[model samples]
Target: MKKTMFAVLAGMLAMGAAQAQTLSTNAADTAPHFYMGTGIGVVKDSVSGDRDRTWKIFGGYEFDQNWGLEAGYSHLGKTGFYVPGTTDYTAAHIKSSSVYAAAKYKYALSERTSVYGKLGLSHGEYRYSSSAPGWNFKESNNGVYAAVGVDAKLTERVSLYAEYERNGKRAWNGPENRIFGAGVKFGF
Candidate 1:
């Protein structure tokens, strides 16, 4: 009886140590050092006639558990509007594209979830076209951009996220472009 009890106690101690080592190794392996993702969503302009489709591709590097840097390119789709009560019917369309770099901050709510915010500088170009007067205009400008979102880890190397972002204003005093979207991120 003494021999049997001694053997069982030793086995339990060895098992506990092995479990601790595995947990530490898993923690190191699950940290996200780099990640990339692409998202497609609806873009709405305050002055435009309707909401349009928007898409973006982004990549980032996490320097630590709480902070990172990101860069992305986005296409804000075209919006069309018609002038009413006109002798000749005419429509105007506006389209835009942007590139931006931002700093990201994350607040972990649990082991699998976090909330984040971003602020950045954006450079974009807008094109306007009208059929009535045969007018076409193009303009480029730089502006400030911002976003807030949440992320939920789905696996060791993948996460799912949803965000609300303001890419930037089209011009100094022009309309702002906004987007709401969800996407998956792959980490390395």
Candidate 2:
């Protein structure tokens, strides 16, 4: 009876080990190693009467499930700035591109849905052009970037996310910007 019991216990242990291996494999498969995404949103200058249609394209590498490095280019489009108390106006085409190394903390709401917050240091160039004489500007800046978002998996390799992000202030007295947008990501 003792030998029989030992054999049964060993078999159960073997099965458990195999099951654990399978679970680990599944988790790794779902974890994103590399991803690329694009989003469209509106960007507004908080200190100026400038608002524009914005779009961004980004790609990143996940070191683990909760940490990643991301780089992106953002086109803030044309922003029309009206001189206060005057009918004179100027339009500036703005573009911001950044590279951020971010830490992401996430809480799983379900098997396929999660909420995450990202905090990072962003280094980028801010460029703007205006039709007004001598109004063109280009500068490089580093600042803090943060975002809170929710992600839902649509497939094993594709997911959709909606996020509100503060892209931080640019150097040289550039206006701060924010974006609320949705994006789709493909994982590899």
Candidate 3:
């Protein structure tokens, strides 16, 4: 009876060890090492209350499941306006773009879903131009940026996410910009 009991206990231990190993391997397989994504949204200008189409592309490297670093470029779109005292004849536009880097933190809600946030710095360029002479201007600004989003995995290497971001001020004396967008991430 003692030998039979010992044999059963040993078998249980072996099975538990095997299951643990399998779980570990599965976790490693799902952890993203590198990823890239692209998204499109509308940028709301805080100064003018205008909405314009915006788009971004980004790549990231995960240090582990919960922490990573990301970098991206965004075209924040163009806004057109009428030159003062010449509303019918003179039109000018402002175009904005930025490059940014951020540290990301993610929290898992399930095996297939997570929520994440990013905080970083961005360098922005804004160009104001018109057919009318003396209306051309260029400026650059640097400021902090932030974003929050949810990610849902469709497969081991592919996922989708929706995000809201503040792209920062266009210039020292210009407007703040915000975006809401969704995109797909490909992991490698």
In candidate 2 the C-alpha lDDT for residue 143 amounts to: 79
Residue 31 error, candidate 3, Å: 4.6
- Model 2 agreement with the true structure over 1-188: per-residue lDDT tens digits: 33543453344334434444333234764465888898776656654646555677888877766667776766655433433343467555555655566666766555556668888877767676776666677878777888887766656567767677777565343435566666788888
* Structural similarity to truth (TM-score) of each candidate: 0.75, 0.68, 0.79
lDDT (0 to 1) per candidate? 0.72, 0.63, 0.75
* TM-score of model 3 (CA atoms): 0.79
Best by lDDT: 3
Top-TM-score candidate index:
3
52-99, model 3: which lDDT tens digit per residue? 678899999998889999999998887766777665679878888988
Off by over 4 Å in 2: 1-25, 29-32, 47-51, 82-99, 170-175
Candidate 3 lDDT for residue 32: 60
Task: Please identify which of the two predictions, 2 or 3, would achieve the higher TM-score against the true structure.
Answer: 3
* Over 4 Å off, model 1: 1-25, 28-32, 83-87, 131-134, 171-175
